[model samples]
Target: MAWNEPGNQGKDPWGNRGGKDQGPPDLDEVFRKFSSRFGGGGGNFNKMGVLLVLIGAIIVWGLSGLYKIEEAERGVVLRFGEFHEIVGPGLKWKPTFIDEVYPVNIQRVNRLNASGLMLTQDENVVTVQMEVQYRIEDPHKYLFRVTNPDQSLSEALDSALRYVIGHTTMDNILTVGRDKVRRDTWEELEGIIEPYDMGLRVVDVAFKEARPPEEVKPAFDDAIAAQEDEERFVQEATAYSRQVEPQARGRAERMLREANAYRERVVLEAEGEVARFTQLLPQYEAAPEVTRERLYLETMEQVFSNTSKVMVDNKDGGSMFYLPLDKIIQGGGSAPMVEQAPANRQTSTSSSGARTTSSDNSTGRSSVRQGRN
Candidate 1:
C-alpha cells in the first residue's frame, strides 16, 4: 500500500527508498541534461571550423590556378578583365578573384579566306578567292587591342584582295601572275593588321580560285583551250623529235652496215680475180703456139654457129674475088652478105689464101679472126 504513493511511484516501486531534493547542476551536467532533451548536440564542432572551411575554399581555388599551358599555347593573366601580365606553361598561379588567366593558342595555325566577284585593273569583273594562314604572336594584342579581330582579319583580307585584284589585269590573275597576286595580298593584309595592332603572324597565302566572271566563262574556256592546244603542239613536236631521231639514226646505221658489206665483197671478188688471172697469164706465156691454136679453134667454132658467109678466090688471082652469087641469090645464108669493108685490088693465089673468120663469146669481147698463109 505505501508503494502506491505518487511521490514514491518513481522511487520505490521496488520498495524501501526515501525521497530527497537534487542539487544545482554543474556545467557538464547541465549540458548533458540539455543534450538528453535534445539529440546528439555540439559533438563535433570547433569555433574555428567555419573560418577554416572558408580559408580552405580560398586555398583550393587559389591552388587551382596552378595549371599547365601546352607547348603551342601562351598563358595571359587578366585582372578583372584588364590585362595583368603574361604567363608561361606549367604550375603557374594568380589570386583567384583578382587575376584571371587565359591560355592563348600560340603555335596553332589559323586560316582565313577572301572571295567574291571583284573588278580587275582592266575594269573587268572577276571572281578572286584567296586563303591566308596565320598564328597569334601577341596574345595581349590579339585579345584586347583589336575590336573583333576575326572580323577585322576578314575585312583586311577582303580589302587586300580587292586592292590587289583591282591593280592586276585579268590575264595575270588567271595565269601568269597568280602567285604574285597571292603573295601581294598576303603582304598587304599583314601590313594592315599590324598597323592596327592586331598581333598576327602571317604564315602563308595562296590562291584557291581565280577566274573570269560567269558571263565570260565561255571566252575563258576558249582561252584555256587555246593554251592547251599550244601545249599539245609542243608535246607533239617533242614526241616527233624523240621518235624521228632514233629512226633516222637506225636507218643511217643500216646504210653504213650495207656499204661496209658491199665494200668487203667487192674487195674479196677483186682479189680472187687477180689471183686467177695471174695463174692463167703464166700458162699462156709458157706455150704461146699451143695456147693460141686452142684459143683460135675454140673462138672459130663459136662464130659460125650464128652466121654463114662463104667467099672463094682462085689460087692465082690478082685483084679479083668471086663470091658464089648463085648460092647467095638462092638465099644461102637467107640474106646475101653485103661487103662492109673497103674493096681491095689484090688477092693471094697460094695453097692457103686469106680468109676472114668471126667468133662470138658470151664474155667481155667479140672478135673477128683473119688467117692468111
Candidate 2:
C-alpha cells in the first residue's frame, strides 16, 4: 500500500508515526550512523579520513621526483635554488618542489662558426671563416662558472679569429698561411677561455675558407696562379739540375780518366826514350863515327817511314836517287830500272848530277835516272 493511503496515514518509510512531512537525512547523521557500523565513532572516522588524504599527497610528491638521465647526459642538482650535487646517468630522485635538475650533454660536440671580412696586418681586407668544435668538460663550470658558456665561447672564437687575422697578411690568409692561422686561433682561443673556467674543451679549430673580396678576386686569382707556376718551375728546374748534374759529373770524371791515361802514356814513352839513349851512350863512346852513322840512318828511317817516297843511294858516288813509290803503286807506272852504261855508250848528265835517258818499255815510256860517279 502506498504510504500516502488513508489506512497508512501518519506512517513514513523511516517508521515515523507522525503525519508531518520529512526532508532528506543530514550528511553528518548519515556519517555517524555509517561509522557506528564500523566500530568507530564519527570523530575517529573523520580523523582517519584526514590521515588517508595526507598519505596520498605524500605518495604523489615522492613519485614526481623520479627522473631518467641518458648515458650522454649529466644531471646538475640544485637544492632550494642552490647548487647541491651532480648526478650521473640512470634513474635518479630529488625532492619535488625543493630541488631542480638540469641535464647537460657532456659527450656531445658543439660547433660554432665565426666568419667575416676583417682587416689583415698588411692593411688588406679578407673574408675569413673558421669552425670551432668543442664539448663540455665540466658540467658545474658549464652551468655556473659563467652566465652563458656557449655565448662566451662564441665570443672568444670571434676575438681569437680576429686577432690572428689582424696579425696576418692577406696573401697568407688566403693561401699558405691558412693552416698557421687556424693553429694560432686555436691556441689563442684556449688561452682566452682557460682563465674563465667555462668548462669548455676545444676539440679542433678549422680554417674553412679565406679569400679576397669579390672586387679583387680576379687579381688575387691571377697572383695565386703565378705563384703556383713559380713553384712548379722551381721544382722542375731543381729536378733538371738533379738529373743533369750526375751526367755532367760522370762526363767530367771520364775526361779526367782519359787525360790521366794520356799523361801516363806520354811519361812512359819519354822514360823509354831516355833509357834507350842511356844504353846507346856506351856504344857511341866506343865507336863514335860508326854509332853516329847508325843513329843518323835510324833517325832517317824513322822520319821517312810515314812518307810515300823511296830513297836509293848511289854506290859509286855520294848522290841519292828519289822515286815516288806511292804514285807507282797507284798505277802511275813503275820507275825505270837504271843499268850501268858501257864505256862506249854515251851518257847525258843533268844538273842534279844524275844521267837521264828516255827509253821505251813494254808498258810505256819511262825516264831512266843514273847517279854521276
**Against the true structure, whose lDDT is highest?**
2
Give the lDDT of residue 344 in candidate 1.
Answer: 39
Candidate 1 lDDT over residue span 1-373, tens digit each: 4554556634453333463433333688766676656545555333355678989998899787677777778888889988878877676777777888889998888998889999999998999888888889899899888778878898999998999999999888887789899888988887788778888888898799988878889999899788779879999999999999999999999999999999999999999989977886877899988877777655554654355543333334334344344554455333323222223322222111223333344653323333233
The TM-score between candidate 2 and the true structure equals 0.60
Q: CA lDDT, every prediction?
A: 0.72, 0.81
Candidate 1 off by > 4 Å:
1-49, 80-82, 231-373
Give TM-scores for every candidate, taking all chains together and pairing residue i with residue i: 0.51, 0.60
Question: Tens-digit lDDT track for model 2 on 207-310?
Answer: 88888999999999999999889889999999999999999999999999999999999999999999999999999999999999898767766775543334
Worst lDDT 10-window in candidate 2: 346-355
CA shift of 154, model 1, Å: 1.5
